[model samples]
Target: MKIDTTHLLSAIEDYIAKADEDLRDTLENEGFVAASETVRHIGEIEDALEDVLDEDALEFLERVKEAEGVDEFLSVSWPDIKNEGDLEKALYEIFRQKFDEMFRSFTFSWILAEEPEIVEDISGEAIDTITKPAEAFIKGWSGELSRIMNLNTKDSMEKMLLKAQKKSWTIDELAEAIGDSGIRNHGYRSRRVALTETLRVQSYAQQESMIQNPLAYSKRWKHIMSDNPRENHIAMDGQEVFKREMFELTGRNGETYLVLCPRDTSLPAEETVNCHCIMETVENENALGMTADEKKELREKYIAEVNEEYEAWEQKFKNDMGIEEPRDDPSVTWEIYNSYYEAYRKGEIA
Candidate 1:
């Protein structure tokens, strides 16, 4: 269940590349990204931004044109999104599917350790391995997207307005000054979310592996940072420190590092977003401490807990959304969505 950083990062890259291609398809001939500087429209920068994009960006520009609200567009359009084609939702679903498939293979790998003769599915219990973390993944993904969007739109628009006050500017001038920050923000934020989600799935698999076969390995968690050629100092320091340390290592200066877990980090932004660090669980002698019966009991209890958590989430989702959970789909995606949305609605996620 350790973080396979290489595999995980490649997964993220594939997702981003796919997302960009999908978004481009959505944008193609949609009047979302402006193509030409037709004569009458060439005069003003505002017109370019207005005609340059539609969908969310156009919605935002409409607010500006009408002389209305500041944060007029999607103050996070996730709530209104219903399908898979949405940028954020699409990103989540991609990782969800990939991670689920990977974890299926991941869960099956345990069979190879002792019972090499048979290949069997955990059947009912397998869904929990994905649903539980997926619940958190969506919530985190939405939160991070909102944060990046707010900062990018507020700051970028403010600077654009400031510069526009001084003199008239062309489409290129204003765009260069303000930048297509929304795209940048989304791209960067998506990377962070994708990386984090992939790791989380791996972490859950680790948990599942541990519970199912406690004696298989006394798995100790370790932080495995990337050998990214463009790695930064904070990541380097994190790599150096946790590279040799174990899980739950505490700093002499009272800083705490949850090595294999997510969030609650003391690292600066320089290390987190686009970060290539990962959690790796290695076997230790203590793995043999738990007896066979104890391992089975632990595994049963864990699966039960995961099932309860997702059931509760699904129930709440049904209660709150006034719709039955998706009966046709194999994934607990809607259930996870409901859980995370409630968290966001109650302000518990932040």
Candidate 2:
């Protein structure tokens, strides 16, 4: 039976546009939570320093300047201040809770926007695709978020020491400088996370929705330029591919990548961050010249094949990354992600 997807596609487009528009507010709200934690952590660090230096910035500066290293001074005086793990833990929890909520809500809203006749029911296979990948996505992002925050802390501390040596400042002045450093910009960092991950989940949801859709046969890439547009993405506008096939994207180093959709976590941040492109699902006019029952049968068979392939890949990925299972406190690092991404580019993971 032929399926009319004109109305369904329109609804999908409208829903996506609305989601895109709301991204700014969503990011700001998440950023506010992160900002609150950042302020609290910075206050604690300042208090710890005061205890060690007796609120004498000049004395603290002179002692550190004479020490073998800033790290040595800090470590000897206030060992507990080195524990920026508190910030990492706080950020991870914020991201974990937000990601879980976004995934479920976005997926549900997308389904609800579909034409009733087109979406008879959601299947177990569809649920599996949605839930499993979302869990992995959240775990991976938590690790990534912590890594960035750790780097920020180290860099900020180094800068703080340098600034103290460069100028004659009171304790309050030094404290203010520390608060103004990059480590204290957790709210801005959270906004970046929100923008990228929101697109990630939305793209994943769109792809899975098309895969579960009996009438969806292909998808076309429609590139929407952000403030800064990627040349390759612009060149790929109107590019079409099979629903299950991957899009070939070229990196800055001229490296090639196969990604399922825009902002795919599998790709490096250079390619995925703040991407505004979209994949528009195309319905088969005649449903491939098959009845509804036949279409459903074909979809089921495809799902089984795809699931088997995916399970094997996921197992290999976990093994290669040494991730036995997802955990609340993920220790995965940026190096691990880069190594796996490199391996994937070389077709090692497949």
Candidate 3:
């Protein structure tokens, strides 16, 4: 099955652009009116946040009840479900799984709902990468809130755990500024954090969508090809790219590499924004002719050959220029490696 990287990338970009526009409108419509409100009423905002947490805990229980049969919920599951300690552990796991599904489903559904042309299967790894941070954040937030609930209240452990969200009022700001440094900092921090946490799921899904399509293409290639490519992975990008890219299986100095799928690595958010790079799986058919062990041995041999070439070139340049210092020049070596690889590909050298 051929995954259309172009369509997927465009859908993801379009979704983000639309979602961000909606979010900006929400923030502006909500935020503009609040500038004059000030911060004396921070307590009200805290109460709202608490209400979110409360609703989440209760809602989770409701979901669990709905998902599990009465026989299951009332049976062995009860022991763990009712046990405060065990329940918390179970709930976190449940939340992690639930949100992972929710974000993936929601984001994918959001696109399919609108465009309907974006039909691609997403990988578990990609789903986890995009959704895990938000899951961790929510888990931590809920756990912390549960720890602080009033024991005297009718609040259950579940309610305590889930009680959580942000912002408003003019005197709210003035009171915060006047009362305590932490108060202002706290308010600011709370709003900012709330926004971040709220946005995390969507942002991650968007970021993952930005790359998952092209990524799936590589994955599909791996799945269908009985002889998977063992050589260097190639990077392909459009006419317009941060840098229209390329890759090597082995560097001139014998440095081996594996291509990273976009958003899989820890490059900054801006780096992946609108990035059109897709990895082209390049396999050495000759490498596949050998057994697995033989393939490994050949790789080691190739590395040694490259290293020897590098050492000889460095020595030659050093002696020829009469430079006492031996410098490892990447640019010079890179050209040599490129030429060698190009020649190798053309059947001129191996």
Candidate 4:
């Protein structure tokens, strides 16, 4: 099935604008950082979705049309419903059921609500809310989907990774395994590219975390500190601990190390905004032959590369937009990446 990305992008932009307004009002009135952050995160997710939709405009349109049809069906007249309340409830139930089915069929994942005003109702005000963020979300999600599709374009390579991980086959693999699958592209280049990008993000997050919590570094990495462990020993082992813990948690088999944000502490509200702990894998670390200093140097070198790439991308975006002076907002970038990652995990973006 095909999908249209434009409609989805428009819907997401609207949703994000509304969400930002709501979050600002909340933050200004009561200093509700958590709630405000949630809204901001949603906005980022919307932005990510927009990026995806822009990549494959046609397919996005098709999916939106299908979803709209489902919504229309739920709204259409039913022969047996007589009460308004019953009708509303019935429509909600039907929409939820149908939406779930559609998402499963398409291997898409995202949150949907019976009422767009649900958040406002919860917030106890007539806050601006997107009644149907999905319309826009799908559009924004398409870009990521296209990237994922491109990554999973090879049959043998797809199977190799899945087999290595010992996980059940995914939609990408299923489509490839079956000869009649609609998808065409599937290869290692895509997988490697995706993995590398993810690693870069992880490294960025780690550095941001460290910069935000300098004190935490001493407490967590005491071994590296000037004080001896038996004397004035601090827990200056956070970065190393974080690296080990994250590697184990991701099941990368110690291949990947947490490059950024090695300690777990509440950062300043601004710094912690949309922070997602990510880890990077060192090739030599996997070989178990590299010393700690070697690994650290390699990670630092990789971080430099990530920063250079980021600067290039930022410059390109500014050039494309014809903006002589771009706003320095890490929060915005964080939100965008976080949103895309959330959509991917949720299957909202293939």
- Top candidate, metric lDDT: 2
List lDDT for all candidates, in order.
0.42, 0.58, 0.36, 0.32
Per-residue CA lDDT of model 3 for 1-350, tens digit only, reads 97769988999889955755664555334321121111212223333444444454454345344533333433444345444443333333433443355456544533342222333343565333332223333344344323332221223432322321012223333233323433112344334333433333333343333232221112111111113322222212311211112122242235543222332222333333323223223333343444544533443353355456545654555566576764444334334333433443454533
Better of 2 and 4 by lDDT: 2
What are the runs in model 4 whose C-alpha is more than 4 Å off?
Answer: 1-35, 47-51, 54-206, 212-216, 219-258, 262-350
RMSD of each: 15.0, 13.2, 22.9, 22.2
Scored against the true structure, residue 205 in model 3 reaches a CA lDDT of 42
lDDT of 4 at 26: 47
Number of backbone clashes in candidate 1: 4
**Runs in model 3 with CA error above 4 Å?**
1-102, 113-115, 118-179, 183-185, 207-350
Q: Could you say which candidate leads in TM-score?
A: 2
| Per-residue alpha-carbon lDDT of candidate 4 for residues 69-180, written as tens digits (9 for 90 to 100) | 3223224421111122322233223323332223222211011111111122223211212111221222222333333333433233334334423545443443334333
What is the lDDT, from 0 to 100, of the residue 99 in candidate 4?
29
TM-scores, one per candidate: 0.44, 0.62, 0.25, 0.23
Stretches of candidate 1 above 4 Å error? 1-55, 61-121, 124-155, 162-197, 216-218, 221-246, 249-255, 259-268, 280-298, 305-350
What value of lDDT does candidate 4 attain over all alpha carbons? 0.32
Candidate 2 residue lDDT tens string, 195-309? 5665666666667667666677888887876679889888878888887677787876688877777776667788878676777778888775666567656656655665665
Q: Cα lDDT of model 1 overall?
A: 0.42
